[model samples]
Target: MDFKLSEEQQMLQDTAARLVRDAYGFEQRESYRRTKLGYGADFWAQLGELGLTGVPLPEAYGGFGGSGVDSMLVMTELGRGLCLEPYLQSVVYAGGLLAQLGDDAQKDRLLPAVASAQLQLAVAFEEPQSHYHLNDVQTRAEAVNGGWRLSGRKVAVIGGHSAGLVLVSARVSGGERDEDGIGLFLVDPQQAGVRRRVYPTVDGFKGCELFLDGAFVDAGSVLGEPGKAFAALRYQQGRAIAAQCAEAVGAMEATCDLTLDYLKTRKQFGVAIGSFQVLQHRMVDMRSELDQATSMAMLAACAADQPDSDERSRTLAAAKFIVTRAGRYIAEQSIQLHGGIGLTDEYAGSHYAKHLVMISHQFGDDDHHLQAYSRLMEVC
Candidate 1:
């Protein structure tokens, strides 16, 4: 129940905030958006070198051996900076899964590269029809030639185009959405029949649609037990969503601060707009929502690392749903309060707004999470 941040956590937050302000500012983000990578390679390298990428990883894997809270803190700062780098993809999605389920051999081979930023990863789970359920995957991984032949289409795969490896979720037995018989496998992007078409998302990040036709993976490539992969993947996804919720909270915080600062200086009727009661009320409302989102983010992060599966699902869903709804409202209010200039690209509001929009939809939207919450509540 203690809510205070430790000194180390405070230092990490300060460091991240400073780094974003000094290096990952608006102009830098704009410049990097046009690059083929759609992000700063050097900045990512620096983060890796600084051990930020390995903060939540195990010490045995060349990481800092920190807990999930550490990763949440870092991602929160990344969001505050409006960072375009795919830190979530490499760390939360790929690394979390690998650490939790991959064997020691897999860890020895992949964790070092990930820790050093020498290799990047992306998770391929979504399908054209499979919706947001982690176990709703329809991609098939049929046994073939002493291995598996994967053939399916995954859409909206973040960072897939540039990933050195892709951890894919496929259905072993051909059928519609079901939790049973699902499998997770590591696939090399250079393999034949694995195609990635990269595209830009609204938040200035790269997402790709993967077409795997007869893509082969050795038996050793499976990350975990075939029929039991869903729980592990879902756990990793909850953690990933928790990180994103924290990130959204960060963006909302920045949005509120930016709006408040603008109100203080912006003149209307020959006076500071902030002095107006109506404007002050709007700012107060934004701050309230931001605070709620932050609280929910912390709850979700804690729940994500919990040992109880049922509790983790419920807490995560509730937290995600609450944060998504509140964060969206705050971002929209920020843009509206900023007036016509807010919608323009030059203004920082637009960037934060776009990121908020993307975050709201990622992993699960408000509606998705709400349904999950309902289902969990009914079961419990």
Candidate 2:
């Protein structure tokens, strides 16, 4: 397969990169970090106006009708710039799920708003003790007069506090943690008995913990077939992981860029530090690591569009595994090369380091992906 980007894709990358560098620089991010929202509403609206919030969605849904690869490009740039917006959680994760599983009525009512960024959505799937297992949901949804009532707690629901709606996954039949009995419901955040507590993350975004006493929704709110939402969730999860890997690749690239600039400026023994053979070798190694991570991210993005689930999982796990390891190494080397000042908040090097660390642990970390890859390999 051709790895080169088309003209359109290149333009998308350039637009996102420029927007991050010019409109929402590090200073803006710092200000946002101090805010209660942990992100600026204006910044998100600007991204929506630029069509970034809808790139990978369908044109019918108010999107630009781009592909997964295009979405990955935008995500990478966001990572490189250390953006505070939850574009991935709202657009790629929740929007993709709605598009794939929502019925015509559900899609017509919800997806257009999501694509236009008028209504932000988040997936409330993770439980307190589920670890990374998608099927291990204790949240329960039971049949009612005309709909379902959700009752349970969801921990670490990214962007849930600010979300207009939530795509909730719960056990509809059989026991909790059953793979075939899972269901998804579209719930309004303003509904009765719903409570959220928000917390800031190291990367400047916000996540939430939800306590649902009895959240109710119409039966039509069901996204797909009853007891079969796991397939859709898995598909969305793969896409999310792919986007995150792309982001990690972007952070790795930024780390290399920052380190190179540092090496050229700082002097030692009346000469530029970059002239030293030791630092030069380190720069060379960083370049190699970044290149490998980028290649793996590209491969994973391609695989996310494949029809086979098993193939997608294996490819994404491999990408996540490679990118996280490389990202961790690059982040460490960047700080080490820059010395003590690198840890200061004013330094660009520190931002890259923090973002890289966050990305390395998101979705699934190195160990999680390694185990997944090992399991897939055994079955294959």
Candidate 3:
């Protein structure tokens, strides 16, 4: 298969890269991290103005209607800059879910704002006990007076603290672990009975624990049929995983570049450390891992926009597994090559390492995807 980017894709990639290069310097990133929203609001608005926020959404709703490859190009640039915006959460994951599962009225109302970045969204599917199992929903949703009441807790809701709306998954019927009973609801964060406890994440980002105490929502807030949203949730999560793999590839590439540069400039034994044969071999290994990660990321991006199928699921799981492992290796190796300086927060390499390591934990980690891939193999 051909791998070269189309002219349009290259232009999108360059646009994202240029924006990141000009605006996301390390000190600037740190300042953004210190903001109330934990990212640069102006930078996010710039993304909207430039149409980057709409890259993967439907065109009918103020989007570009681009494919998953388009999203991959943008995400790679964001990862290279260690950007802390909620593009993955608000645009790719929540936006795709809305496009797939929302009714005509819901789509017409919400997607345009999301595409324009006028409204930020967060997803609350993970429970403390779910452990990455999309079907293991325990939060309860009950019908009441032509509406619904949700009561449960959602943990690690990334970007939840600042989101205007949060897409929450709850069980409306069947057993807690049953796949047939899950429902997705669009909830206003400021509504009665909703509470959020925000905190900083290990990788310098922020997230929140969402508490819903009988939060009420009208019928219009439900996405698709109640208790029928599990499939869509899983499918959109696969798309997010694909984008995440691409981001990891970008972080890995940045880490490799930093290590190689350090070796060339840092002196050891009256010469550049890069002149040593041992370190040179390690650098070669890091590059090999990056190359492998790049291939898997490309495979994931190609498959992410395709119709849902067993093949697509299997490919995504495999891609995520490979990329997670490669990212971990690259992160560790980059830090080691940089020695003590790499661990300092002031250095870009350290931040890249942290971001690379954290990428594994999102969606699912290496071991989780490995098991998922194994199960799919058995099904095949």
Candidate 4:
């Protein structure tokens, strides 16, 4: 497979890298994180101006019609910067869902705003007990006089704190854990019975726990086919997992670069620590791990478009396992090699390390994906 970045992809990557290097340095990130929104308004506008917010959506909706790989290039740079913006929740997680499942009217109405960063969205899918189980939907949406009444709690919702819209998954029919009864609805965050308890993630990104007490939605709010949203959910999640793996690869590579630089500049025994064989060996391993992880990230993005469902699942699970494991290793080694400075709040390395580590636990952890891969392999 050709691994070289295409010209457009390279341009996207370079533009983002330059923006982060020039404007989103460690000091800027610190200030951005301290805001009530956990990010800067101007920063988000800048990203939108750069065409990143629209990269993955259709041009009909004011996007650039970029594919998964093109979006991956943008994500890699965002990860390298340890961005605090809600682009992942807004674009990858929510915008992708809208692109796939939204009706023409809905897409025409909202996707343009989304692409321009005028609106942000978060999916309220995970319940407290959901863990990584996609089928577990305790949130219930019951038919009402003219629409639906939704009630449930969604925890650790990645961008829910500041979302203009929320895509809620609720059980419209069968039992709580049944996969067939799922329905997804677009809800207004400012609705009567919706509440959000916003907080920062371990890596200083925005997160929230949302409570919906009989939140009302009209029939028009239903996205795609009712009680038939599982396929769309799975498809969006597969894309999200692939995007995250790309981010992890970028984070790990950035961490490895930082570590290698630190080793060369920081002296020990009156000489550069990089001169020592042991530290040099560790740096070598870090680089190799990063390369392996990058390959898997690319593979995952490719597999997202595979025609066969089983092939896609098996390939995704396998790629996720490799990327998560490599991410963890790269994160830990970078910190260890940097000594005390690596953990300091002011250092970029610590944030990168935290982000990479936190990513392993997102979407699905190492054990979850490993077991999934094993099961898929068994069936194959």
Candidate closest to the true structure, highest TM-score: 3
lDDT per model, in order?
A: 0.87, 0.87, 0.93, 0.87
TM-score of 2: 0.96
Q: How would you encode candidate 2's per-residue C-alpha lDDT over 56-106 as one tens digit per residue?
A: 788997898887799899999888878878798999999989999988888
Off by over 4 Å in 2: none
**Tens-digit lDDT string for candidate 1 (100-203):** 88998999999988987888899998888777877787788888888999998999899998999999999896456678788999999889989988899987
lDDT of 3 by residue, 42-77 (tens): 999999999999999999999999988999999999
Q: What would the TM-scores of all predictions be?
A: 0.97, 0.96, 0.99, 0.97
Which pairs clash (backbone N, Cα, C closer than 3 Å) in model 2?
none
Off by over 4 Å in 3: none
Q: Which stretches of candidate 1 lie over 4 Å from their true place?
A: none
lDDT (10s digit) by residue, model 4, range 32-105: 99989888789899888888899888999999888778878888888888888888778987898899889999
Superposed by TM-score, candidate 2 places the C-alpha of residue 186 at a distance from the truth, in angstroms, of: 1.6
Clashing pairs in 4: none
Backbone-clash count (model 4): 0
- Minimal lDDT window, size 10, model 2: 303-312
Clashes of 3: 0
